[model samples]
Target: MTAAVLSSPGATPPSKCFTIDKEYPKPTLPSQTWVLVKVKAAGLNRAELRGRNGDEPAPPEFGMFVDEFHPDPPKILGEEFVGIVEEAGSETKFTKGDHCTGFIYGGGKAFDGAYAEYVICPSQRCFKLPQTTLSWETLGATTMSMWTAHGSLFQAAQLTKGSTALIHGATSSVGVWATLLAKAQGCTVIATTRQSSKVDKLKSLGADHVLLEENLGDHLKKLAPKGVDCILELVGPDTLQTLALPHLAKHGSVVVTGVLTKQWAMKDFTPALIPPTRKMTFYSLEPGQEEDEGVEKVIEQVIGKVEAGTFKPEQFLDRTFSLEDVGQAHEYMEDSKAVGKVVVTVP
Candidate 1:
């Protein structure tokens, strides 16, 4: 087997090619546990970029229990996967040849990820895909980003019908999925982009309004005089100060997800001496950090909605690349020129 390795931390660790060089160690299958998935496609995430650049810390506590061990570059760099189950351990409902997708616990950190030909995962993280869910490319793309959006909007934020949400970077994979899901939940969605060009395009996807990032304050003041009910913050520190505290609606919440900006940048803010009547919150999708078991339950619910007409993965795939082109894919994502999700095909 061969996989991509991040040799060291820097800007973009050039996707160095490396042979698995030896037989993949057989994954331990305890009673009522484990499944062998022959991976078909794997998705690229900014987490992979950060891990490659050493921006992320070491694996968390659960890594030991899950056997998530890693050398310098990790066995490979990827997180979630969609594949066919070739084998299942005892006392498990899943059988041979189940088409499924799930979290790889500490993928891209402790163990090899879906970028390779095969992977082993706990059956708990895997879910059976509906007939409507075809193509490994689509499955690979959604599990992490889409699941994050679903969890943030509906669970963490407790979004409800008739609520309004401002999804920053609305054209990206998570942003686009959040916008659609918010709309499906009957909320008025306001999406934002630094580029004014995407404003109209965002509106076409049921965004009630699309505003420039620079004009976020003015637009919110005017359009949402009462203030937005929820905000999905993906741009990280750049937008944090302006989007927090007093700016939020009464009891409103913000989901802080990413920091896609120049490193070591400083932000300025004048702190409020008193807590605003409006509430504020922050969250990361880092595994083992979130306490909400509701997340998995909501994921299953969103998967059901995916089976229906509401969620669509096609909107998010900007382009596809061969595993050999993985470096180019990283370049595209880091440059921020590409819109939505950029996926890689292992074959």
Candidate 2:
């Protein structure tokens, strides 16, 4: 199997770090444990950028118990993939030829991943994807962004119809999904972006309001003075602590789904900053598909919406590249050139 190996870390232009290996050994499944997938396409994620830069991702303490491993260097780097199951554990729900998509726990961050024509993952994390006319390039990008968006809005925030929801970092793929999901639920959606250029584009995606990131607090004050029912805070604590939280409606929920500002934690944080009865917390789906079956339902719901024409994947997919250009795709992402998901197709 051919694979793109992260041969060097922190190389100039970054794309030089990847070297395509035509003769790389393909992965095989562990007896009764994992599924082998023939990847049709894979999505590049911000996590892959960390791996390519040798960020030394915290090793999964549970890896050995689960038979998972993360190679030190020269490993394939891809986090989410759309593919078909070539093999599955007998006791698992999956089977041969099943079309699927999934989030790889340590993909790129830890081990050889979907950057190859083939990859193997724990059976639990992979799930059946909805049948759609959407290209693999678009579907490949859905898992990471959609799962976060859905889980944050519905599960973490518990948003409901007639509610007013605000999405920060509104141009991100996750933000786009949140806008669509919120609107489909009959909620009024407000989105924020640093770019005035994206304001119109976001409104077309169902946001009732789109505003520049500057003075977000004052803008929210005038537009939604009663506060929003849910706040999908993606820009991190800098904005969350100072601008967004005070605008939450009474008993409203704010889920911190991403730290695009790179401030993962905060200084001088105080619970007092949270208004009386309001809730704010960080959010992420448990590393992989869990026994709870919650992740599967989220995937199904989002896809069902897309299938029903209530949501459009084309609205969020920025562009696609051939698998061989995986490095260039990463470059595109790191350069902050993509307004949405950047994907790579195998064919």
Candidate 3:
């Protein structure tokens, strides 16, 4: 088995740390609740890139929670995958040939990941795909992005139809899905992008209004004079405090989903920054933490939308790389050249 391993820290160019192991051992089920998956395709995430490059610190308890643990510091590095079940433990309901798509709890941090021919994960973490005409590539790319979007909007923000939403970094995978999903729910969406070239693209994706991220306060104020009902703040804390907080409607919610600007915590952040009556919440889709928190329902809804020709995952796939080219996939995601998700296919 060949797996992409991250061994050392503080490596220059980041990609230097990604090494492919030709003889990596295949994983086996550690418990009756576990299942072995023959990976077909895997999705790359920015958090994994940051962890591999030492740009972000690995979770403190990483590699400490796997059922069948490996004693390696640098672990396998994929977060989401779509694959077929090769084996299922006796306690699990999954059959040997079930097609599944889901995320690992800690993935690259806790255990060997999906960047190999096989992956072992708890059976409950896998979501059985519905009978649809979608390809494996689309299903693989949908998990992390859609999970984040669905969780942030429906769970954290509690969005309702006809409400107004402001989404930053609207060209990101989660941003694109959030835009389409919010639109489908009848929300008037105001999406932002730093690149002017993406304005029309976002508009076509159903954003009611599109604005450049630079100096967006006045434009956002004018678009939603009464303030927005919900805000999907993906750009980070700076944008949240300076631009989003000021425009939150009474009882409105702002769900902080990503740190694309690389600033995790806000400087001088205080309760005074938020409106007296509004709410600000941080939403994270950690692999094990929220896997059962209505995720299957969201997955079913998203799949239904896709099957009904309402949501198109294919439109969000920018490129695909082979497992050997996992380093390049990480580079491409970090370069910000891609308009959507970058995926890697397993051999």
Candidate 4:
């Protein structure tokens, strides 16, 4: 098996970090709960990029249980995948040849990931794919990004019908899904993007308003007057401090999901910064936390919408690369050239 392995850490370019291991050994099932999956397709996430670049701290959701700064063996770094079960344990529900798609908690760092021809993960971590006409690319891209968006909007923020929600980084995979999910729930959606080209794209997905400027305070004030009921802050702390905090409505909540700007903590953050009666929170997809919290229910609900034609995962796939071109994939993501999810296909 050939795998992309990152043996060292620090802000090194991905091209240098990701070396193809032509003779990588196939992973064996470690327990009755584990299963081996033959990789079909995998989606590249920004969190994995951050982990490879050594820029920010790795999220607990990535299954990176080891010291990422210094891994004894090289680490595999993919989060979401769609694959066919090659083997399974007796205690697991999955059987050989079952097609599955879902996230692997700490897959790349704590364990191996789907960057290779095959990946071994706990059977409980995967969701058996429904027999639908949807392509493997779409199903593979659906897990981590969609789950994160769904968790942020429906679970963490508790967005409801008639509520007004604002989303930053509207062109991102999670942002795109968040906008659609919020609208499906009957909320009026206001989305933001740095690129002007993504304005119409977001509008088609049911965003009531799209903000392209850095300063969103004035536009938000005019659009919602009393401010938005909920905010999905994917652009990080600068947007949270200068734009989101000041415009939150009474009792409104802002869920911080991503740090696209590469800044994690808000400098000089104070409790007084939040408006009276409003709340701000951070949402992370913790390892084993989603299962414990019943997030699979939400995943199934969203997938049902996708299968019914209420949601379109195809629209969110910007480009696809062969598994060997993983370096180029990360480069494209870092350049911010893709408006949607970038996928890698294993031959």
What would the per-residue lDDT of candidate 4 be over residues 145-256, giving only the tens digit for each residue? 8888888887788888999999988888888888887888899999998888778888988889999766677777888888889989988876677888888899999999
Q: For model 1, where is the 10-residue window of minimal lDDT?
A: 56-65
Q: What is the alpha-carbon lDDT of model 3 when measured against the actual structure? A: 0.79
- What lDDT does candidate 1 reach at residue 62? 27
**Which regions in candidate 2 have their CA more than 4 angstroms from the true location?**
56-74, 287-293
Q: List the residue pairs that clash in candidate 4.
A: 62-106, 63-105, 63-106, 64-106
Better of 1 and 3 by TM-score: 3
How does residue 156 of candidate 1 score in lDDT?
77
For model 3, how does the per-residue alpha-carbon lDDT over 1-347 read when each residue is reduced to its tens digit?
A: 88877766447565677778888888888898989999999988766776676664324324235454443434787777998999999998799999887577466666777888899887767778767677778877677688888789988999999899998888888898888889988999999998887788889888999999777998888877889999999888777777888999999999988778777788988888787999999886555554557777677778787777787765577788988887778778887767668889998
Q: Write the per-residue lDDT of candidate 2 for residues 1-347, one digit (tens) a residue.
A: 88888788878677788888899999887667788899998977766777788764434412322354443543787877999998898877888988898677565654568888998877666778766677687677677688878878988898899999999887887888788778888999999988887777888888899989788788889998898899998877777777777789999998987767656566788888778899997776564436463776677777776767776766778889888887788888887777668888885
Total clashes for model 4: 4
C-alpha TM-score for every candidate: 0.81, 0.90, 0.89, 0.89
Give the clashing pairs for model 2: 70-110
Clash number for each model: 0, 1, 2, 4
Candidate 4 residue runs with Cα over 4 Å from true position = 7-16, 56-74, 286-294
Query: lDDT of each structure?
Result: 0.68, 0.78, 0.79, 0.79
